[model samples]
Target: MGLGAGPPAVKRRSFTRASVAVAVAVGLVLAGACGGGGGDGDGDGDGDGSLSVGVLLPGGGASRFGQFDGPLIEKQLKRLCPDCPAPTIAATSDPAVQRQQLESMITRRVDVLVLAAVDPQLLRPSVEAAHRAGIPVVAYDRLAQGPISGYVTFDGTTVGRLQGEALLKAMGTKARGGQIVMMNGATTDPNAGWFKRGALSVLQGKVKIGKSYDTVGWRPENAFVNMTRAIAALGAGDIDGVLAANDSLAGAVVAALNAAEVRPLPPITGQDADLAGVRRIVRGDQYMTVYKPFEPAATAAAKMAVALGRGRTVGSIATGTVDSATTKNIPAVLLPSVPVTVGNIKGTLVKDGMYTIDQICTPALRSACAKAGLTR
Candidate 1:
């Protein structure tokens, strides 16, 4: 997660001060290259028998990026290619930083890149550069622009629809022409648009959208500010439910509702079955969160990266193809997602081994967990 330690140091060049400085400087460059570099490949274009995978994750506050996707992808890659070098994994919320990281990976000549772009449009040039360098890019989790060879992610529309349907269920009678707020993810992410489209398909004509905001950076603070403003505009009593883009935004929305002293908080929908989100559901704060199983998607991405690195076709592994803003008919594997409520925590997260009962039912949550029938 921390990109491991820097590569080992090189020996001193000479006793002279200048030589020593040169050696140290050269050592740092070598360290960076080694840390980020992929395995060597022959001109045959199939990379050497040993493949190096460069994985770029879009930040880590979501929990899944560091806790599940990173480790699971590494494990699957090892299973598929024992001799493959450990993936050069990097993550940052800043779009510029992510772009620089992608360029570094491309310069290192990594056979393949697995990228979850922080900003799809901003990363297009770098993705194009990778393509020019003959490195296949596999867009992971989020579909990126520019000549991507493959993609692996859950059905974005389905995820949003599930969240919308669950919010309606939680709202019950109020769902009949109720007033709801929409907290969408960053506009930079293509999936945000897909999710909004899908949620609109279910929520339109059925509910009054009192307020909607496109959160920047997908940051909780941004969501909090938006939610607080929404609360001010709509007043507590007028709001019936909230359509939160993900668990992080959901948390922020809940915080704002609490700050406004709204008693008996309205139903809130979220995606990414983050632990905090799950606990919030048990405590009756959040209505539900969509669980997009990470293992299968991670496995598929790893296998695709490996296959692409080996100059092999991903058709065998990709279940379908997707078109991006800049690319068409790109091979893809779109997994399914499940809406998780307090009642199905055990049947979903627990059963999937994403969490243990003890992990969810902490001492503080014992009573809540018991009431939710999550004990033992």
Candidate 2:
């Protein structure tokens, strides 16, 4: 945070999300569906006054949830359903644990489920089980398969394009002859494919990829090991840039570069404007990160869940639609992302209150921050 700026404002009852929920409930009820509160708290069948929402998050590999997703989601849920019993959220970092958690939520019979699956396709059967039980599922973030009613996510293709463009810009004169190592996300998560395809579309023919590896679970450690291997295979100096899929991978890649004793690390790209990524940007450890404003994505998910819970149409909420493997015409809200570098750190993340200069530029990084003109 900034020197005098206090902790970020993250509160449970601070958001304004109930109008859409209430209105949807009222509308559906008038239209002959016994909408709003199924006694299970989905507000789907009858206005029973309680909602049990199980939020099955994917992992702890990234800090997005601990920092932003959890509180924002909780706050939105509570604001949307004030008098209803507080919504229940079962959060776990492990996929196997998440599977058990999913079964538990199924056993508990949560009214509505918002999940960001670790393995989207692997969770299909579990999602189908909830569907079998007539529970409405809102596929959050990862877009788990099966009979999902709604979806919310940032545009992966757009994110990849941003990464590619930034990598090229960072490479400067080396852009054409640049030999970048691709540290991509797992093949299991379909979004990884989406991101990779977008990056390849922009990067192909323009740059030569020396070596690439899919880091399972988007693990920083895995990326670190892979980066080490890449360095050994293709001399550290030959690699020009790194197309790290997200911030965590970029962290691993940078650490590997330091270990290899590469004087000035090549320009590396990442997604998720993680604090670590931001700090890396300020310190020039990493080149750029895709700053996806999670609030808008969270807001869209909140609206979709509330609407689906209330049995209302999503016409007002849907920004556009997307197609999944099994489901087509899936009503979705895709938010755009931006590229953040040292040049615009203050204007981008600082101005948006995502991070503060103080939180970023510690005594160790003060000089670098000044060099980047991040200090006022």
Q: Alpha-carbon error at 115 in model 2, in Å?
A: 0.7
1-376: candidate 2 lDDT, tens digit per residue:
0100111111121122222233234223222222363322233333435667777776543478757776667766665655445555666656677778888888888878888887766678889898898778887777777888877776677778889999999999999977999999887777787788779889999999999898887888899999999999999789999999999899999999999999788999988889888888887889999887666566556656666666566544554566666666666655567788889888778877778889888899989989988786
Name the regions of candidate 1 deviating beyond 4 angstroms. Answer: 1-48
Error of 1 at 96 (Å): 0.1
Report residue 92 deviation for candidate 2 (angstroms).
Answer: 3.5
Q: What tens-digit string does per-residue lDDT give for candidate 1 at 1-376?
A: 0101111111111222122223233223212111112332112223236888899998764467988888888887776666677999998989999999999999899989999999887899999999999999999988888999988887777778888888888889988899999999888887887788779889998999999998998999999999999999999889999999999999999999999999999999998889999999999999999888777777778767876777767664555677666677788776667788999889878876889999888888999999999988
Candidate 2 regions with alpha-carbon error over 4 angstroms: 1-48, 60-62
Q: What is the model-wide C-alpha lDDT for candidate 2?
A: 0.74
Task: Look at candidate 1 and tell me the lDDT of residue 183.
Answer: 100
Models 1 onward score TM values of: 0.87, 0.85
Best by lDDT: 1
